[model samples]
Target: MVSEAQLRTIIAEAVPTIDAAKLPADVAFADSGIDSLDYAAILLALQERHGLVVPDEDLSRTASIAGILAYAAEHRSDA
Candidate 1:
């Protein structure tokens, strides 16, 4: 089970400008100081590292940390 702490590391790696650990779980990435490009990088990292893939159509569903966790819980595959 992935935790918020782990996600914060991913976020920090994806965007080194901000303190990912301090970011709000409910805040959307765009509203939490993450730009589109950084958000994309974070998503890609999630896919590559954790196998959590967010398709184009469901992009809106995973805009925040909470949303990402929920999506990962629902869709993540260990295969």
Candidate 2:
């Protein structure tokens, strides 16, 4: 199972400006200056790294780190 900590690292890599450890889980990425492009890249990185199939309709729910963690928990593949 992929832990939340690993997800945090993935998020940190996708948005290089912010330190994931310092970021709160519930805060939106926009709070940290992440734009739409950054968010999209984050989604792409998650899909590529973890083989997660986050539908377009579901993408809005993943605007925050905690949200991403939740989505990954539900949809992550057993790779």
Candidate 3:
């Protein structure tokens, strides 16, 4: 169970220049100014941090913070 704080920290590290406070937890990544490269970077970061490999298909479908959170939760054991 990744806490909200952890998620925020991840986003902060991924996009240091962005004002994460203005971003909603359930908002889509596209609407949050996260481009494809940023998304790929995030997926890599998650893999390095949690030792879990997120599939490309899953990454494609994860458009929102909430969606990512749910995916992480479901794959917690793998992490």
Ranking by lDDT: 1, 2, 3
Over 27-72, each residue of candidate 1 has an lDDT whose tens digit, in order, gives 9999988999998998888878787778899999989999898888
**What's every prediction's RMSD, in angstroms?**
1.5, 1.9, 1.6
Q: For model 3, what is the C-alpha lDDT against the true structure?
A: 0.75
Q: How do the residues 1-79 of candidate 3 rate in per-residue lDDT, one tens digit apiece?
A: 5655666777788888787666797888888898888777777777787665778767655566788778878888976
Residues 1-79, candidate 2: write the lDDT tens digits. 3467877787788778878778888988888777888888877877777776678898788888888878777765631
| Model 3 residue 57 distance off true place after TM-score fit, in angstroms | 1.3
Number of the top candidate by TM-score?
1
User: Would you estimate the TM-scores of all the predictions?
Assistant: 0.90, 0.81, 0.83
Best by lDDT: 1
* C-alpha local distance difference test of each model: 0.86, 0.77, 0.75
| Native-to-model Cα distance after best TM-score fit, residue 45 in candidate 1, in Å | 0.5
